[model samples]
Target: MFIVFLKFSENKSLASQFMDGHNQWIKQGFDEEVFLLAGSLQPNLGGSIIAHNTTLVELQNRVNEDPFVKESVVTAEVFEISPKKADARLNFLVGA
Candidate 1:
């Protein structure tokens, strides 16, 4: 599994032009069973995502395709994770 941490440079703001594409990517990720959880930090400062069973390369490629990344709205750091347990209430478990 991998955790993708997105830190949008303070200089940039979310772009309306990229919103739709970003939403689409989120949908696609969910459909592909890769994206586990995603949300932004408080006050809309950066974001974080959990992707299941994905390689850093694959995650980077996926992020590269994001309109936010393409437009330089945010930079990302990817980390490998070994989740000992996932909250059932959140539906974050890979296999339920």
Candidate 2:
């Protein structure tokens, strides 16, 4: 799994201009089953995505194509994690 963090950049003002494209990119991730979850940051300063079903390199490649990255509206950092355990309800995260 991966935790992708998007930090609002100084160019955040340009976000509105690229939102449509960004949303399309997000939809593509979901359609391809690369993203498991996505939502805003606690302070609304940025956002984060929980992704799976993709390799780190592939995820990085995809992120590079994001409108936010292209227009410098946000800076992204990815953290890769290996799921070892999960509660029964979410046990699927730790493959059998």
Best by lDDT: 2
TM agreement with the true structure for every prediction: 0.78, 0.94
Candidate 2 wrongly placed segments (more than 4 Å): none
Superposed by TM-score, candidate 1 places the C-alpha of residue 25 at a distance from the truth, in angstroms, of 1.0
lDDT of every model, 2 decimals: 0.77, 0.91
What pairs collide in candidate 2?
Answer: none
Which tens-of-lDDT digit does each residue in 1-96 have in candidate 1? 888877787536665767798789888888898898899877877778888756678888997887777787778788886666767774554442
TM-score of 1: 0.78
Q: Tens-digit lDDT track for model 2 on 1-96?
A: 899999999999999999999999999999999999999997878889999888899999999899999899999999998888888886767752
In candidate 1, list every pair of residues with a backbone clash.
Answer: none
Clashes of each: 0, 0
RMSD (CA, angstroms), candidate 2:
1.3
